[model samples]
Target: MSGKGDCYDNAVMESFFGTLKNEWVHHQQYQSRYQARSDIFKYIEGFYNTVRLHSSLGYMSPNEFEAKYHDNP
Candidate 1:
């Protein structure tokens, strides 16, 4: 990851967090750490993995790609 053209090692994570904040975090004000964690978990599991389309995965959600992989492999 330290080689040439590998400078974007954190690019994927940065992009994910950027999307998280843009689509989820910025719209809400949390009253507690537990509440925020719970809601974020719900968003990630119930919505992000199940429904959000990822361009890097050919526009499939994580669950869809995983299912396809299991079906073929």
Candidate 2:
């Protein structure tokens, strides 16, 4: 476990969740927490991982980046 008040310990994860909520969760309405959870899972696993482009990755999707990296290596 991280020490108390150690913001750096979770900075990357906090940024990810903030982006996830801002880009997807805040724009949707769901009937239940379960439904929201299911949709979020699909968004992250199905769409975001495979399709969404990342500026930090030179506009390549995560899947694309991994494939290119592995193929080149």
lDDT for each of the candidates?
Answer: 0.90, 0.93
Candidate 2 residues 1-73, lDDT tens each?
7898898889988988999999999999999999999999999999888889988899999999999999999
Q: How many Å off is the CA of 41 in candidate 2?
A: 0.2
Residues 1-73, candidate 1: write the lDDT tens digits. Answer: 4666674877878788889999999999999999999999999899987889999899999889999999999
RMSD of each candidate relative to the true structure: 3.4, 2.1
lDDT comparing candidate 1 with the true structure:
0.90
